[model samples]
Target: MAFVKTSGYRGLHVFAPITPTREFLDVRHAVIGAARELARRMPTRVTTNWWKEERGERIFIDYNQANRDRTMAGAYSPRPLSHAPVSCPLEWSELAQTDPHAFTILTVPNRLRDQGDPWATMHEQPGSIDVLYSWWESDLADGLGELPFPPDFPKMPGEPPRVLPSRARRPD
Candidate 1:
């Protein structure tokens, strides 16, 4: 759960130390693969940058907080509530057992911290494998509609437009 640094575009800083099972591959590869899969499911963009590291690998995913808000009409229906419910990570040990190949079924806005650092962490596998099986009992896909847009967001069409405030007037 180490905070890397704030991204140039968004306020979200790059976080690392997400303990995972045996990581024979590089961190960027794993993260990019996961994010690519996420892009296939959602209507969002993702980016990554490489930085120097001493030991274990580090992966970074940058997303716009503003895009979180959009029309959720096609999401959940029949249900009275506007959004669906989601579940949190069961435990750190549980996530360790999760099959790395399994496409994560995120019921909630997943935080990287909960996933643990795959670069340095280790756990038993095969028989007694622990995994954070996201509760898919409910329509969590529908619940994604509940998330609100980021704060101080500009109401406009197309990639959220940005505008700088006017400069202060100088005294005479």
Candidate 2:
């Protein structure tokens, strides 16, 4: 797994490369499975909640990022913030001590030359998502059903409504 800091953002991106043998939905299921397990193990510290209002102070694991055609900033991509912080890949050893603000657009190139890419071998071996599929099935059986999709995406069966929970009309 590669741990990265989205400089100027509130969360970390944890990535593990998977074999490209499945469709986007299948991959999403795998990610959701992993995220659910993390939330289960660390209920107070993590969340898979689709809405920020529900997420509270927990770190949100965005399994929805697996959705097809979705775009995301890549490693070293500079954020639009005034400080120009880059989406920096982190070395596990340094992750605890490093500050994201220090890896701005002006500093990353020299850091890269000195340290090399922390994710250089990320694709040296891709794993199958089939193992995670079992967890997804377990979650389904436990009634942890589909999460909400992006508002512009076509409606998916079993998805929670796209409206924010605060705005949704409560049943009388």
Candidate 3:
């Protein structure tokens, strides 16, 4: 299951499952597929800023974090950045008004005491990505294809050319 939380100021924070096989390509595909589904379900527009341009509006999926070396901050873990903020979980309704910076290592424990863990039942029932993978297949059949992978990784099967769209050769 994927849980998306608005970070109030930065952007959306997505929490998704990771399979033990650690296949980077599969992870990337699943995340993008889920993001597309999320955009369709959400009330707002979404876009991926791969080219660093204002490409209209869309739910931007930061897929670079899907790589083998990167990770989203775990719940209750303190981020190593300047303020030492913790990755806290909140009710979806609380997200809009909550200040992320206030959930530091110092305050998380007290919040947990007062309100209890929002994700306490997260593991009670596991979720499968079968639906998302099915969506990927459906999209492929509809001609919506692969997005670019990170430059450092090997060119994946079915991936478009690694060049930025602006630099790619136009077909005659």
What do the candidate models score in CA lDDT, each in turn? 0.30, 0.84, 0.69
Sorted on lDDT, best first, the list reads 2, 3, 1
Q: TM-score for every candidate vs. truth?
A: 0.22, 0.92, 0.75
lDDT score of model 2?
0.84
lDDT of 3 by residue, 49-120 (tens): 466554456557776777677655667777776777777878777867888888877888999999998777
Residue 88 local lDDT, model 1: 25
For candidate 3, the lDDT comes to 0.69
Candidate RMSDs in Å, in order, are: 19.6, 1.5, 3.4
For residues 1-172, write the lDDT of model 2, one tens digit per residue. 4455554465577777877899999899988998899999999999999889999999888888889987777888989989888888987788778787888889999999998988888898887888787899899999988887877899999988889888999999
Q: For candidate 1, what is the TM-score? A: 0.22
Which digits, one per residue and each the tens of the lDDT, describe model 1 over residues 65-166?
213342221111122323332222223344545332222223223434555433232222222111211221122343421111234555533322232213
> Evaluated with lDDT, which candidate comes out highest?
2
